[model samples]
Target: MILDAISSAAGTSSAAKDRAGIADNFDTFLQILTTQLKNQNPLEPLDTNEFTAQLVQFSQVEQQIKQNENLEAITQLAAATAATNAVSFVGKRVSVSTTQSELTNGTANWQYSAAKDADAAKFTIRDSAGKVVWTGERDISKGDNNFTWDGRDAGGLKLTDGNYTLSVSAKDADGETVTVGIAAEAIIDGVDFSGEEPLLLAGDTTIPMSSVKRIHNQ
Candidate 1:
């Protein structure tokens, strides 16, 4: 019965549930052992070795459950600390490694770095619905370059303010594809903890902590 409880506790969905089940089962085992020891016949006494082993098993399971609970508390504490630290990023400018950017006040910006000097470079802007809204050519550079969009389509019509994605393709002098890394910069307006981890609210998009490259002065 104790072994079955241990197995069930191991497969429980949450640490709290597992701890509760383990404690309950451990108590029940102790109660049963106590009762047996109290009512055992003098001629056919409960074997000391067997009861001792059962007590040892209960102790081991209890220790394991306690360790699990401690570790869970530590993890929760770490997550809370991270979320608290993220709050400081609000109102600060942050650069994140992502292809998506939000257009606000008629402008959006992105940063890109080319692996090598490119002979030709093409930039494409796509709306949130994955529709290409604008296309333009950019000057090839060896390293980092910044691109700005004025929230206009290819035909010079203004588009509504929303999230957009920018992609760049470049070819080297020998016609080989040049690798490019894309990023965006924005001010953190708020912190979001509704997800598995905390996210920085940057304009209309949420930036994960892993994606953040740098934080800058506002």
Candidate 2:
């Protein structure tokens, strides 16, 4: 019976449940063994070697279960600490590697770095519904460059304040593509822990912790 319990203990969802079941079965097994030894006749003595071995196995299993529980406790504590640290990112300005940035009031800013100078560098701005609102050419040399939008469309029409996506394509004089690194800066307003990784919320954009590059104090 104790062997069967051991087999089933692996299927238990939590360490606490496994410990409870094993403890109950171990106690019952000990009581049965003690009573049988007491009632055995001296003329035909019962060997206790098998019972002793089983007792040792049960002890090992119980010790392993206790260790698992302790490890689980440590894991939970570490998760709590990570969550607390993520929460502290709120209200702090951060720069993250992403294509999307929020347009507020009248301006939206983005940063990009170029590996080599391009003869022709063109960029397009799109709104939430994948509609291109503006398109313009930029002078992206072999260094860092900042692009700012005035919340206006291609025809000088003002657009609503919301999230915008910027896409850039560049080619050198020889028609070879230039590598560009794009990033955006925003103040983290909230955090979403529902996903596998903690996400920092910044005005309709969900930025993963791994994507963040720098933190600035407000």
TM-score of each prediction: 0.83, 0.81
Q: Candidate 2 residues 165-215, lDDT tens each?
A: 988899888899998888889999999999766788887788888898889
The runs of at least 3 residues in candidate 1 whose Cα sits more than 4 Å from the true structure, single-residue gaps closed, are 1-31, 38-44
Best by TM-score, which number? Answer: 1
Candidate 2 least-lDDT 10 residues: 9-18
lDDT of 1 by residue, 142-172 (tens): 7888889999999999999989999998998
Candidate 2 stretches greater than 4 Å from native: 5-18, 39-49, 193-197
TM-score for model 2?
0.81
